[model samples]
Target: MSLSVVICCYTAARRVQLIRGVQSALEQAGDRDEILVVVDHNDALLADLRDSLPHQITLITNEFQRGLSGARNTGVARSRGDVVVFVDDDAVLATGALDGARAAFEDPTVVAIGGAVRAEWAVGSGPSWFPEEFGWVIGCDYRGLPACGERIRNPIGAAMAARRQALVEIEGFSTELGRVGDLLAGCEETLMGVQLQSRFPGQRIIRHTDFRVDHHVPADRATLRYFTRRCYQEGRSKAVLTRISGRQAALSSERSYTTSVLPSGAWRARRNPRRLLALVIGFGYTTAGYVTGLLLSTRSAAAA
Candidate 1:
Protein backbone atom coordinates (compact mmCIF):
# COMPACT_ATOMS: atom_id res chain seq x y z
CA MET A 1 0.00 0.00 0.00
CA SER A 2 1.16 3.57 -0.66
CA LEU A 3 2.03 5.63 2.44
CA SER A 4 2.01 9.33 3.12
CA VAL A 5 4.26 10.57 5.93
CA VAL A 6 3.35 13.87 7.57
CA ILE A 7 5.75 15.78 9.87
CA CYS A 8 4.90 19.04 11.66
CA CYS A 9 7.77 21.36 12.64
CA TYR A 10 8.32 24.83 14.06
CA THR A 11 11.48 26.73 15.06
CA ALA A 12 13.70 23.72 15.84
CA ALA A 13 17.28 24.99 15.76
CA ARG A 14 18.52 23.52 19.01
CA ARG A 15 16.65 20.32 18.29
CA VAL A 16 18.23 19.80 14.89
CA GLN A 17 19.88 16.73 16.35
CA LEU A 18 16.47 15.06 16.07
CA ILE A 19 16.51 15.50 12.28
CA ARG A 20 18.99 12.69 11.93
CA GLY A 21 16.45 10.41 13.57
CA VAL A 22 13.83 11.41 10.99
CA GLN A 23 16.30 10.92 8.17
CA SER A 24 16.62 7.29 9.23
CA ALA A 25 13.03 6.77 8.00
CA LEU A 26 14.18 7.42 4.45
CA GLU A 27 16.05 4.14 4.55
CA GLN A 28 12.79 2.26 5.19
CA ALA A 29 10.44 4.20 2.89
CA GLY A 30 10.17 3.41 -0.79
CA ASP A 31 11.32 6.04 -3.31
CA ARG A 32 7.71 6.53 -4.45
CA ASP A 33 6.54 7.29 -0.90
CA GLU A 34 5.91 10.93 0.06
CA ILE A 35 7.15 13.09 2.95
CA LEU A 36 5.15 16.23 3.70
CA VAL A 37 6.84 18.67 6.07
CA VAL A 38 4.42 21.18 7.59
CA VAL A 39 6.25 24.29 8.78
CA ASP A 40 4.24 26.39 11.20
CA HIS A 41 5.47 29.94 10.74
CA ASN A 42 9.15 29.07 10.73
CA ASP A 43 10.44 30.40 7.44
CA ALA A 44 14.15 30.11 8.20
CA LEU A 45 13.91 26.53 9.37
CA LEU A 46 11.62 25.76 6.44
CA ALA A 47 14.27 27.03 4.02
CA ASP A 48 16.95 24.99 5.74
CA LEU A 49 14.78 21.87 5.64
CA ARG A 50 13.94 22.33 1.98
CA ASP A 51 17.60 22.71 1.05
CA SER A 52 18.64 19.69 3.08
CA LEU A 53 16.01 17.23 1.81
CA PRO A 54 15.45 15.76 -1.65
CA HIS A 55 12.81 16.96 -4.12
CA GLN A 56 10.46 14.13 -3.13
CA ILE A 57 9.87 15.95 0.17
CA THR A 58 7.00 18.45 -0.05
CA LEU A 59 7.25 21.55 2.17
CA ILE A 60 4.16 23.54 3.16
CA THR A 61 4.57 26.87 4.95
CA ASN A 62 1.57 27.47 7.23
CA GLU A 63 0.77 31.15 6.67
CA PHE A 64 -1.20 31.60 9.89
CA GLN A 65 0.76 29.06 11.95
CA ARG A 66 -2.46 27.35 13.02
CA GLY A 67 -0.90 25.05 15.64
CA LEU A 68 -0.12 21.31 15.30
CA SER A 69 -3.64 20.03 14.75
CA GLY A 70 -4.35 22.53 12.01
CA ALA A 71 -1.01 21.79 10.38
CA ARG A 72 -1.72 18.06 10.35
CA ASN A 73 -5.09 18.70 8.76
CA THR A 74 -3.41 20.83 6.12
CA GLY A 75 -0.94 18.08 5.33
CA VAL A 76 -3.60 15.40 5.26
CA ALA A 77 -5.76 17.39 2.88
CA ARG A 78 -2.86 17.72 0.46
CA SER A 79 -1.56 14.18 0.69
CA ARG A 80 -2.45 11.19 -1.49
CA GLY A 81 -1.96 7.77 0.09
CA ASP A 82 -4.02 4.73 0.98
CA VAL A 83 -2.50 4.91 4.46
CA VAL A 84 -1.49 8.10 6.24
CA VAL A 85 1.35 8.04 8.74
CA PHE A 86 1.95 10.84 11.22
CA VAL A 87 5.54 10.98 12.48
CA ASP A 88 6.72 13.66 14.86
CA ASP A 89 9.40 15.69 13.17
CA ASP A 90 11.72 14.94 16.08
CA ALA A 91 11.22 11.16 16.06
CA VAL A 92 13.07 8.55 14.00
CA LEU A 93 11.44 5.38 12.75
CA ALA A 94 13.13 1.99 13.18
CA THR A 95 14.34 -0.02 10.21
CA GLY A 96 11.72 -2.41 8.71
CA ALA A 97 9.11 -0.69 10.90
CA LEU A 98 6.84 0.48 8.07
CA ASP A 99 6.83 -2.93 6.40
CA GLY A 100 5.57 -4.47 9.61
CA ALA A 101 3.00 -1.69 10.10
CA ARG A 102 1.67 -2.35 6.59
CA ALA A 103 1.31 -6.01 7.44
CA ALA A 104 -0.73 -5.27 10.57
CA PHE A 105 -3.14 -3.10 8.58
CA GLU A 106 -3.90 -6.07 6.36
CA ASP A 107 -6.30 -7.15 9.10
CA PRO A 108 -9.56 -5.42 8.17
CA THR A 109 -10.40 -5.13 11.84
CA VAL A 110 -7.26 -3.11 12.63
CA VAL A 111 -8.12 0.55 12.04
CA ALA A 112 -4.97 2.07 13.47
CA ILE A 113 -1.54 0.84 14.64
CA GLY A 114 0.84 2.55 17.08
CA GLY A 115 4.54 1.85 17.04
CA ALA A 116 6.25 1.69 20.44
CA VAL A 117 8.59 4.53 21.29
CA ARG A 118 11.95 4.32 23.11
CA ALA A 119 13.90 7.12 24.73
CA GLU A 120 16.79 8.25 22.61
CA TRP A 121 18.53 9.53 25.73
CA ALA A 122 17.30 7.59 28.72
CA VAL A 123 20.82 7.99 30.17
CA GLY A 124 22.31 11.22 28.83
CA SER A 125 19.20 13.41 28.69
CA GLY A 126 16.94 13.17 31.75
CA PRO A 127 18.63 11.22 34.50
CA SER A 128 20.99 8.27 34.20
CA TRP A 129 17.95 6.15 35.05
CA PHE A 130 14.19 6.75 34.98
CA PRO A 131 13.22 9.33 37.59
CA GLU A 132 11.74 7.47 40.55
CA GLU A 133 9.40 10.27 41.68
CA PHE A 134 7.90 10.90 38.26
CA GLY A 135 8.32 7.54 36.60
CA TRP A 136 4.55 7.06 36.69
CA VAL A 137 3.79 10.57 35.48
CA ILE A 138 3.12 11.52 31.86
CA GLY A 139 6.07 11.65 29.43
CA CYS A 140 7.93 8.97 31.38
CA ASP A 141 9.16 5.63 30.08
CA TYR A 142 6.19 4.09 28.23
CA ARG A 143 5.38 0.59 29.57
CA GLY A 144 3.85 -0.55 26.28
CA LEU A 145 4.20 -4.30 26.71
CA PRO A 146 0.50 -5.00 27.09
CA ALA A 147 -0.73 -8.53 26.36
CA CYS A 148 -0.93 -9.33 22.65
CA GLY A 149 -4.73 -9.58 22.82
CA GLU A 150 -5.22 -6.29 24.65
CA ARG A 151 -6.33 -3.11 22.88
CA ILE A 152 -4.69 0.21 23.72
CA ARG A 153 -6.65 3.30 24.80
CA ASN A 154 -4.56 5.67 22.76
CA PRO A 155 -1.71 5.65 20.27
CA ILE A 156 1.28 7.92 20.68
CA GLY A 157 1.02 10.52 17.91
CA ALA A 158 4.73 10.32 17.13
CA ALA A 159 4.48 7.02 15.32
CA MET A 160 0.95 6.15 14.29
CA ALA A 161 -0.55 4.99 10.97
CA ALA A 162 -4.18 4.82 9.87
CA ARG A 163 -6.30 4.15 6.85
CA ARG A 164 -6.82 7.41 4.94
CA GLN A 165 -10.58 6.81 4.82
CA ALA A 166 -10.79 6.59 8.63
CA LEU A 167 -8.92 9.84 9.03
CA VAL A 168 -11.18 11.56 6.51
CA GLU A 169 -14.30 10.34 8.31
CA ILE A 170 -12.97 11.69 11.61
CA GLU A 171 -12.12 15.03 9.95
CA GLY A 172 -8.49 14.96 11.11
CA PHE A 173 -6.96 15.84 14.51
CA SER A 174 -8.62 18.17 16.97
CA THR A 175 -7.21 21.62 17.67
CA GLU A 176 -8.09 21.28 21.38
CA LEU A 177 -5.75 18.36 22.14
CA GLY A 178 -2.40 19.71 20.99
CA ARG A 179 0.03 22.24 22.51
CA VAL A 180 -0.58 25.98 22.38
CA GLY A 181 2.75 27.68 21.78
CA ASP A 182 5.46 26.26 24.09
CA LEU A 183 2.94 24.52 26.31
CA LEU A 184 2.84 20.69 26.20
CA ALA A 185 -0.90 19.94 26.05
CA GLY A 186 -1.72 16.47 24.68
CA CYS A 187 -4.47 13.79 24.24
CA GLU A 188 -5.33 14.64 20.65
CA GLU A 189 -4.39 11.12 19.67
CA THR A 190 -6.65 9.67 22.37
CA LEU A 191 -9.53 11.85 21.29
CA MET A 192 -9.10 10.66 17.72
CA GLY A 193 -9.02 7.03 18.86
CA VAL A 194 -12.31 7.43 20.68
CA GLN A 195 -14.02 8.49 17.49
CA LEU A 196 -12.37 5.69 15.54
CA GLN A 197 -13.45 2.95 17.98
CA SER A 198 -17.03 4.15 18.18
CA ARG A 199 -17.39 4.44 14.44
CA PHE A 200 -15.90 1.01 13.81
CA PRO A 201 -16.59 -1.47 16.65
CA GLY A 202 -14.65 -4.76 16.87
CA GLN A 203 -11.96 -2.93 14.97
CA ARG A 204 -8.81 -2.88 17.04
CA ILE A 205 -6.24 -0.16 17.57
CA ILE A 206 -3.22 -2.40 18.10
CA ARG A 207 0.19 -1.48 19.48
CA HIS A 208 3.05 -2.90 17.46
CA THR A 209 5.77 -3.67 19.97
CA ASP A 210 8.28 -4.38 17.24
CA PHE A 211 7.48 -1.25 15.22
CA ARG A 212 9.62 1.21 17.17
CA VAL A 213 10.68 4.83 17.07
CA ASP A 214 13.41 6.70 18.94
CA HIS A 215 11.93 9.85 20.49
CA HIS A 216 14.67 12.41 21.06
CA VAL A 217 13.56 13.90 24.34
CA PRO A 218 15.15 17.32 24.37
CA ALA A 219 17.15 18.26 27.49
CA ASP A 220 14.67 21.03 28.20
CA ARG A 221 11.82 18.51 28.43
CA ALA A 222 13.82 16.52 30.99
CA THR A 223 14.05 19.57 33.29
CA LEU A 224 11.62 20.05 36.17
CA ARG A 225 10.44 23.38 34.76
CA TYR A 226 9.50 21.90 31.39
CA PHE A 227 7.72 18.95 32.93
CA THR A 228 5.70 21.22 35.21
CA ARG A 229 4.67 23.34 32.26
CA ARG A 230 3.74 20.22 30.32
CA CYS A 231 1.63 18.93 33.20
CA TYR A 232 -0.15 22.25 33.55
CA GLN A 233 -0.90 22.54 29.87
CA GLU A 234 -2.21 19.00 29.77
CA GLY A 235 -4.49 19.60 32.77
CA ARG A 236 -5.85 22.89 31.52
CA SER A 237 -6.41 21.68 27.99
CA LYS A 238 -8.21 18.61 29.25
CA ALA A 239 -10.60 20.64 31.37
CA VAL A 240 -11.21 22.94 28.43
CA LEU A 241 -11.82 19.96 26.21
CA THR A 242 -14.46 18.65 28.59
CA ARG A 243 -16.34 21.92 28.21
CA ILE A 244 -16.06 21.75 24.44
CA SER A 245 -16.61 18.02 23.81
CA GLY A 246 -18.91 17.10 26.74
CA ARG A 247 -18.87 14.20 29.26
CA GLN A 248 -17.08 11.86 26.84
CA ALA A 249 -14.12 14.18 27.04
CA ALA A 250 -13.90 13.36 30.74
CA LEU A 251 -12.17 10.12 29.75
CA SER A 252 -9.26 12.17 28.54
CA SER A 253 -9.48 14.25 31.71
CA GLU A 254 -9.17 11.07 33.78
CA ARG A 255 -5.91 10.28 32.06
CA SER A 256 -4.77 13.79 33.01
CA TYR A 257 -5.87 13.19 36.59
CA THR A 258 -3.89 9.94 36.76
CA THR A 259 -0.89 11.86 35.51
CA SER A 260 -1.41 14.22 38.44
CA VAL A 261 -1.53 11.61 41.22
CA LEU A 262 0.52 8.70 39.88
CA PRO A 263 3.76 10.19 41.17
CA SER A 264 2.75 9.63 44.79
CA GLY A 265 2.14 5.95 44.11
CA ALA A 266 5.60 5.81 42.58
CA TRP A 267 6.81 7.66 45.70
CA ARG A 268 5.38 4.93 47.93
CA ALA A 269 7.51 2.46 46.00
CA ARG A 270 10.60 4.66 46.46
CA ARG A 271 10.74 4.04 50.24
CA ASN A 272 10.65 0.26 49.66
CA PRO A 273 14.19 0.30 48.27
CA ARG A 274 13.03 1.27 44.77
CA ARG A 275 15.13 4.48 44.48
CA LEU A 276 12.43 5.95 42.29
CA LEU A 277 12.27 9.20 44.23
CA ALA A 278 12.99 11.44 41.27
CA LEU A 279 10.03 9.97 39.46
CA VAL A 280 7.92 10.61 42.55
CA ILE A 281 8.95 14.27 42.58
CA GLY A 282 8.13 14.56 38.92
CA PHE A 283 4.64 13.19 39.49
CA GLY A 284 4.07 15.45 42.49
CA TYR A 285 4.90 18.47 40.40
CA THR A 286 2.72 17.10 37.62
CA THR A 287 -0.25 16.85 40.00
CA ALA A 288 0.33 20.35 41.24
CA GLY A 289 0.62 21.70 37.72
CA TYR A 290 -2.57 19.95 36.59
CA VAL A 291 -4.54 21.42 39.47
CA THR A 292 -3.21 24.87 38.68
CA GLY A 293 -3.89 24.41 34.98
CA LEU A 294 -7.48 23.26 35.50
CA LEU A 295 -8.23 26.37 37.51
CA LEU A 296 -6.69 28.59 34.89
CA SER A 297 -8.64 26.84 32.15
CA THR A 298 -11.92 27.32 33.97
CA ARG A 299 -11.23 31.02 34.45
CA SER A 300 -10.15 31.48 30.86
CA ALA A 301 -13.31 29.79 29.58
CA ALA A 302 -15.49 32.05 31.75
CA ALA A 303 -13.68 35.12 30.46
CA ALA A 304 -14.07 34.05 26.85
Candidate 2:
Protein backbone atom coordinates (compact mmCIF):
# COMPACT_ATOMS: atom_id res chain seq x y z
CA MET A 1 0.00 0.00 0.00
CA SER A 2 1.26 3.48 -0.82
CA LEU A 3 1.66 6.01 2.04
CA SER A 4 1.16 9.76 2.11
CA VAL A 5 2.99 11.57 4.93
CA VAL A 6 1.58 15.00 5.79
CA ILE A 7 3.46 17.60 7.90
CA CYS A 8 1.58 20.74 8.99
CA CYS A 9 3.77 23.76 9.68
CA TYR A 10 3.15 27.34 10.93
CA THR A 11 6.14 29.33 12.26
CA ALA A 12 9.32 30.22 10.34
CA ALA A 13 11.46 29.98 13.47
CA ARG A 14 11.09 26.20 13.13
CA ARG A 15 12.35 26.36 9.53
CA VAL A 16 15.56 24.39 10.06
CA GLN A 17 14.04 21.74 12.34
CA LEU A 18 10.93 21.41 10.16
CA ILE A 19 13.10 20.63 7.13
CA ARG A 20 14.91 18.01 9.19
CA GLY A 21 11.52 16.47 10.04
CA VAL A 22 10.61 16.45 6.35
CA GLN A 23 13.91 14.80 5.47
CA SER A 24 13.24 12.12 8.10
CA ALA A 25 9.87 11.34 6.51
CA LEU A 26 11.53 11.02 3.08
CA GLU A 27 14.18 8.70 4.46
CA GLN A 28 11.71 6.47 6.34
CA ALA A 29 9.23 6.24 3.46
CA GLY A 30 9.31 3.50 0.84
CA ASP A 31 9.61 4.27 -2.89
CA ARG A 32 5.81 4.34 -3.15
CA ASP A 33 5.38 6.89 -0.37
CA GLU A 34 4.83 10.66 -0.88
CA ILE A 35 5.27 13.62 1.49
CA LEU A 36 3.00 16.68 1.65
CA VAL A 37 3.67 19.86 3.64
CA VAL A 38 0.57 21.81 4.63
CA VAL A 39 1.31 25.31 5.88
CA ASP A 40 -1.40 26.73 8.16
CA HIS A 41 -2.08 29.87 6.11
CA ASN A 42 1.16 31.58 7.03
CA ASP A 43 1.93 33.32 3.72
CA ALA A 44 5.46 34.48 4.54
CA LEU A 45 6.32 31.13 6.07
CA LEU A 46 4.86 29.35 3.04
CA ALA A 47 6.78 31.62 0.64
CA ASP A 48 10.02 31.15 2.56
CA LEU A 49 9.57 27.35 2.38
CA ARG A 50 9.28 27.67 -1.40
CA ASP A 51 12.47 29.76 -1.73
CA SER A 52 14.87 27.99 0.62
CA LEU A 53 16.51 24.76 -0.60
CA PRO A 54 13.76 24.58 -3.18
CA HIS A 55 12.59 21.08 -3.95
CA GLN A 56 9.56 19.63 -5.71
CA ILE A 57 7.82 18.84 -2.39
CA THR A 58 4.02 19.25 -2.64
CA LEU A 59 3.06 22.25 -0.47
CA ILE A 60 -0.44 23.61 0.08
CA THR A 61 -2.39 26.12 2.23
CA ASN A 62 -5.04 24.93 4.69
CA GLU A 63 -8.26 25.18 2.64
CA PHE A 64 -10.88 24.91 5.37
CA GLN A 65 -10.16 26.72 8.69
CA ARG A 66 -6.81 27.92 10.06
CA GLY A 67 -5.96 25.20 12.56
CA LEU A 68 -4.30 21.81 13.06
CA SER A 69 -7.45 19.81 12.25
CA GLY A 70 -8.20 21.99 9.22
CA ALA A 71 -4.69 21.63 7.81
CA ARG A 72 -4.82 17.87 8.33
CA ASN A 73 -8.18 17.72 6.51
CA THR A 74 -6.72 19.79 3.67
CA GLY A 75 -3.80 17.40 3.26
CA VAL A 76 -5.98 14.27 3.47
CA ALA A 77 -8.28 15.69 0.79
CA ARG A 78 -5.33 16.07 -1.61
CA SER A 79 -3.24 13.03 -0.60
CA ARG A 80 -2.93 10.18 -3.13
CA GLY A 81 -1.89 7.28 -0.91
CA ASP A 82 -4.20 4.54 0.35
CA VAL A 83 -2.98 5.26 3.90
CA VAL A 84 -2.20 8.75 5.14
CA VAL A 85 0.22 9.28 8.04
CA PHE A 86 0.25 12.51 10.01
CA VAL A 87 3.74 13.38 11.25
CA ASP A 88 4.44 16.33 13.49
CA ASP A 89 6.43 19.15 11.90
CA ASP A 90 8.94 18.93 14.78
CA ALA A 91 9.21 15.11 14.82
CA VAL A 92 11.65 12.89 12.94
CA LEU A 93 10.54 9.40 11.99
CA ALA A 94 12.56 6.30 12.75
CA THR A 95 14.02 4.11 10.00
CA GLY A 96 11.45 2.03 8.09
CA ALA A 97 8.54 3.57 9.97
CA LEU A 98 6.27 3.83 6.91
CA ASP A 99 6.88 0.17 6.06
CA GLY A 100 5.58 -0.79 9.51
CA ALA A 101 2.46 1.33 9.02
CA ARG A 102 1.95 -0.20 5.57
CA ALA A 103 2.28 -3.69 7.05
CA ALA A 104 -0.33 -2.99 9.76
CA PHE A 105 -2.83 -2.12 7.03
CA GLU A 106 -2.25 -5.56 5.51
CA ASP A 107 -4.31 -7.04 8.37
CA PRO A 108 -7.36 -5.10 7.05
CA THR A 109 -8.80 -5.22 10.57
CA VAL A 110 -6.51 -2.44 11.73
CA VAL A 111 -8.00 0.95 10.81
CA ALA A 112 -5.24 3.06 12.37
CA ILE A 113 -1.68 2.50 13.64
CA GLY A 114 -0.05 4.59 16.34
CA GLY A 115 3.72 4.61 16.60
CA ALA A 116 5.72 5.20 19.76
CA VAL A 117 7.07 8.71 20.27
CA ARG A 118 10.27 9.41 22.26
CA ALA A 119 11.26 12.86 23.33
CA GLU A 120 14.40 14.47 21.89
CA TRP A 121 15.07 17.16 24.42
CA ALA A 122 16.76 20.36 23.27
CA VAL A 123 18.18 20.89 26.78
CA GLY A 124 19.69 17.39 26.94
CA SER A 125 17.55 16.43 29.99
CA GLY A 126 14.29 17.33 31.64
CA PRO A 127 13.76 18.70 35.14
CA SER A 128 14.06 16.35 38.12
CA TRP A 129 10.46 16.92 39.23
CA PHE A 130 8.80 16.49 35.82
CA PRO A 131 7.83 12.83 36.10
CA GLU A 132 7.95 10.50 33.13
CA GLU A 133 4.34 9.45 33.89
CA PHE A 134 3.29 12.87 32.62
CA GLY A 135 5.30 12.66 29.42
CA TRP A 136 2.14 13.61 27.54
CA VAL A 137 3.00 17.14 28.64
CA ILE A 138 5.77 17.02 26.03
CA GLY A 139 3.59 15.05 23.60
CA CYS A 140 5.61 11.88 24.20
CA ASP A 141 4.28 8.47 25.17
CA TYR A 142 4.05 8.35 28.95
CA ARG A 143 5.01 5.68 31.52
CA GLY A 144 1.54 4.12 31.79
CA LEU A 145 0.99 3.56 28.05
CA PRO A 146 1.13 0.07 26.65
CA ALA A 147 4.73 -0.99 26.17
CA CYS A 148 3.87 -3.36 23.31
CA GLY A 149 1.41 -3.69 20.44
CA GLU A 150 -2.23 -3.53 21.45
CA ARG A 151 -5.62 -2.02 20.66
CA ILE A 152 -5.87 1.63 21.76
CA ARG A 153 -8.61 4.23 21.96
CA ASN A 154 -6.59 6.88 20.15
CA PRO A 155 -3.13 7.53 18.88
CA ILE A 156 -1.46 10.70 19.99
CA GLY A 157 -1.25 13.10 17.03
CA ALA A 158 2.55 12.95 16.72
CA ALA A 159 2.78 9.94 14.35
CA MET A 160 -0.47 8.18 13.62
CA ALA A 161 -1.44 6.49 10.33
CA ALA A 162 -4.95 5.76 9.08
CA ARG A 163 -6.57 4.40 5.94
CA ARG A 164 -7.60 7.23 3.63
CA GLN A 165 -10.99 5.66 3.11
CA ALA A 166 -11.54 5.33 6.86
CA LEU A 167 -10.87 9.05 7.40
CA VAL A 168 -13.26 9.86 4.58
CA GLU A 169 -15.94 7.59 6.04
CA ILE A 170 -15.81 9.36 9.39
CA GLU A 171 -15.67 12.86 7.76
CA GLY A 172 -12.16 13.70 8.98
CA PHE A 173 -11.40 15.58 12.25
CA SER A 174 -13.98 17.74 13.99
CA THR A 175 -13.44 21.45 13.24
CA GLU A 176 -14.39 22.41 16.84
CA LEU A 177 -11.92 20.38 18.88
CA GLY A 178 -8.34 21.21 17.91
CA ARG A 179 -5.61 23.82 18.00
CA VAL A 180 -6.51 27.04 16.22
CA GLY A 181 -3.46 29.25 15.86
CA ASP A 182 -2.41 30.37 19.40
CA LEU A 183 -5.08 28.37 21.22
CA LEU A 184 -3.57 25.28 22.81
CA ALA A 185 -6.96 23.50 23.17
CA GLY A 186 -7.26 20.17 21.34
CA CYS A 187 -9.14 16.84 21.22
CA GLU A 188 -9.74 16.46 17.50
CA GLU A 189 -7.63 13.32 17.40
CA THR A 190 -9.42 11.87 20.43
CA LEU A 191 -12.81 12.75 18.95
CA MET A 192 -11.86 11.17 15.59
CA GLY A 193 -10.65 8.02 17.33
CA VAL A 194 -14.11 7.67 18.83
CA GLN A 195 -15.74 8.16 15.43
CA LEU A 196 -13.31 5.73 13.82
CA GLN A 197 -14.39 2.88 16.06
CA SER A 198 -18.06 3.84 15.80
CA ARG A 199 -17.91 4.01 11.99
CA PHE A 200 -16.18 0.61 11.72
CA PRO A 201 -17.25 -1.63 14.57
CA GLY A 202 -14.92 -4.54 13.87
CA GLN A 203 -11.74 -2.62 13.09
CA ARG A 204 -9.17 -1.87 15.79
CA ILE A 205 -6.80 1.00 16.64
CA ILE A 206 -3.30 -0.47 17.03
CA ARG A 207 -0.26 0.99 18.75
CA HIS A 208 3.04 -0.60 17.75
CA THR A 209 5.87 0.30 20.10
CA ASP A 210 8.52 -0.47 17.49
CA PHE A 211 7.14 1.85 14.83
CA ARG A 212 8.61 5.01 16.28
CA VAL A 213 9.62 8.68 15.96
CA ASP A 214 11.64 11.15 18.00
CA HIS A 215 9.41 14.13 18.85
CA HIS A 216 11.56 17.20 19.53
CA VAL A 217 10.98 18.86 22.92
CA PRO A 218 12.29 22.39 22.90
CA ALA A 219 14.20 23.62 25.99
CA ASP A 220 11.37 25.94 26.93
CA ARG A 221 8.93 23.05 27.26
CA ALA A 222 11.05 21.33 29.90
CA THR A 223 10.21 24.08 32.39
CA LEU A 224 7.68 23.60 35.20
CA ARG A 225 5.54 26.50 33.97
CA TYR A 226 5.10 24.87 30.58
CA PHE A 227 4.36 21.53 32.23
CA THR A 228 1.63 23.09 34.36
CA ARG A 229 0.14 24.97 31.43
CA ARG A 230 0.09 21.87 29.22
CA CYS A 231 -1.66 19.77 31.88
CA TYR A 232 -4.17 22.60 32.30
CA GLN A 233 -4.77 22.70 28.55
CA GLU A 234 -5.09 18.96 28.59
CA GLY A 235 -7.77 19.22 31.28
CA ARG A 236 -9.65 21.75 29.16
CA SER A 237 -9.29 19.58 26.08
CA LYS A 238 -10.46 16.53 28.01
CA ALA A 239 -13.68 18.41 28.82
CA VAL A 240 -14.22 19.07 25.13
CA LEU A 241 -13.50 15.43 24.29
CA THR A 242 -16.11 14.37 26.89
CA ARG A 243 -18.64 16.65 25.22
CA ILE A 244 -17.97 15.21 21.73
CA SER A 245 -17.27 11.61 22.65
CA GLY A 246 -19.20 10.00 25.54
CA ARG A 247 -17.70 10.98 28.89
CA GLN A 248 -17.47 7.40 30.22
CA ALA A 249 -15.21 6.09 27.45
CA ALA A 250 -13.53 9.41 26.73
CA LEU A 251 -12.15 9.58 30.30
CA SER A 252 -11.34 5.93 30.89
CA SER A 253 -7.59 6.32 30.62
CA GLU A 254 -7.71 9.73 32.24
CA ARG A 255 -9.40 8.24 35.30
CA SER A 256 -6.63 5.71 35.58
CA TYR A 257 -4.01 8.41 35.29
CA THR A 258 -5.65 10.64 37.85
CA THR A 259 -6.41 8.01 40.50
CA SER A 260 -3.60 5.49 40.06
CA VAL A 261 -0.77 7.12 38.13
CA LEU A 262 -0.62 10.66 39.49
CA PRO A 263 -0.92 9.55 43.11
CA SER A 264 1.83 6.98 42.64
CA GLY A 265 4.02 9.62 41.05
CA ALA A 266 3.33 11.92 43.97
CA TRP A 267 4.30 9.24 46.49
CA ARG A 268 7.49 8.57 44.56
CA ALA A 269 8.38 12.27 44.65
CA ARG A 270 8.16 12.59 48.44
CA ARG A 271 11.83 11.66 48.86
CA ASN A 272 13.02 14.69 46.91
CA PRO A 273 12.17 18.25 47.99
CA ARG A 274 12.24 19.73 44.49
CA ARG A 275 10.07 16.94 43.12
CA LEU A 276 7.59 17.12 45.98
CA LEU A 277 7.20 20.88 45.55
CA ALA A 278 6.65 20.47 41.81
CA LEU A 279 4.13 17.69 42.31
CA VAL A 280 2.03 19.82 44.66
CA ILE A 281 2.10 22.87 42.40
CA GLY A 282 1.48 21.01 39.14
CA PHE A 283 -1.43 19.06 40.61
CA GLY A 284 -3.06 22.26 41.81
CA TYR A 285 -2.58 23.91 38.41
CA THR A 286 -4.15 21.00 36.53
CA THR A 287 -7.10 20.80 38.97
CA ALA A 288 -7.78 24.51 38.50
CA GLY A 289 -7.71 24.14 34.73
CA TYR A 290 -10.10 21.21 34.82
CA VAL A 291 -12.61 23.07 36.97
CA THR A 292 -12.36 26.20 34.82
CA GLY A 293 -12.81 24.18 31.62
CA LEU A 294 -15.91 22.41 33.00
CA LEU A 295 -17.44 25.69 34.12
CA LEU A 296 -16.89 27.30 30.75
CA SER A 297 -18.29 24.29 28.91
CA THR A 298 -21.39 24.36 31.10
CA ARG A 299 -21.84 28.09 30.47
CA SER A 300 -21.46 27.62 26.72
CA ALA A 301 -24.08 24.85 26.75
CA ALA A 302 -26.52 26.94 28.77
CA ALA A 303 -26.11 29.91 26.41
CA ALA A 304 -26.63 27.72 23.37
lDDT digits (tens) for residues 34-97 of candidate 1: 7788887777887888787667678887643368887887788888887888877777878787
RMSD of each: 3.6, 1.6
Q: Model 2's lDDT to the true fold? A: 0.84
* Backbone clash count, each prediction separately: 13, 0
> TM-scores across all candidates?
0.83, 0.95
The reply for model 2, stretches above 4 Å from the true place, is none
Q: Which ten residues in a row have the lowest lDDT in candidate 2?
A: 49-58
Candidate 1 displacement at residue 92 in angstroms: 0.9
Give the alpha-carbon lDDT of every model. Answer: 0.68, 0.84
